[model samples]
Target: MNSLSNQSRVTYSGTGRRKSSIARVRLIPGSGKLIINGLPGESYLQFSPNYLRISYAPLRTLGLSTEYDIHVKTKGGGLTGQADAIRLGIARALCNINPENRSTLKSEGYLTRDPRVKERRKYGLRKARKAPQYSKR
Candidate 1:
């Protein structure tokens, strides 16, 4: 059995932010297993499955064939936000793994944080852009 200490590896750290959430991730070469806050798959399921899939999609799409074990600690956001943060962390880590691939990753816009978000609702409004009941009377 291969022990973690015995393996030759490079460590990469990245911070991802989305909405009110932030995710910190560490990537190291190993078998593909995502460890979020020291817990494995079970912990990941705490978040929405679609978000998890979206977050991990980049790794495969980018052709990062090297097996990696990812450790992520995310806080302060909803499931969607956390997923986006996770995606950003993975993209950054991939770039660290290979500087030459920066162009590829950058072109995909994985490095940029999505700036769009919900606007604050006004006191009299039901939602950000929605107005209160209009009366002709």
Candidate 2:
């Protein structure tokens, strides 16, 4: 009962990361539905249209927006990072579906991973880049 075996459908998977967030995405043929961490995408994202749009960008680029169901398990960072991670994961899964999808996804810049991350804090610094003021008598 834990897994679906009735359909025997093809499943494609990919992993994405942004900032500190990591997402594992799976694609399966079905009516358009997005599930994240066992919750519906809309509610999980607090019904933010911007977040939904960002996460769905890759599928929209391929014109296969309604043809596949996206299931994601993500952790770390915040919603924005997670959303971008989902986008990259979906793009990769789409490429797994068909190599031809790579050109489209790459041209749309969905295949590129954002390398920016929080810098490590140095000793005597208030934050990663902020430091205590030096006073002159």
Every model: Cα RMSD to truth: 3.8, 2.2
- Cα lDDT computed for each candidate against the true fold: 0.80, 0.94
Please give the range of 10 consecutive residues that has the lowest summed lDDT in model 2. Answer: 1-10
The count of residue-pair clashes in candidate 2 stands at 0
Q: Which residue pairs collide, candidate 2?
A: none
Candidate 1 lDDT over residue span 89-130, tens digit each: 888888887887678778888889898776888887889879
The TM-score of candidate 2 is: 0.94
Tell me the TM-score of each prediction against the true structure. Answer: 0.78, 0.94
Candidate 1 regions off by >4 Å? 1-9, 46-49
User: Model 2 over residues 1-137: C-alpha lDDT tens digits?
Assistant: 53676557789999999999999999989998999999999999999999999999999888999999999999999999999999999999999999999988898899999999999999899999898998997
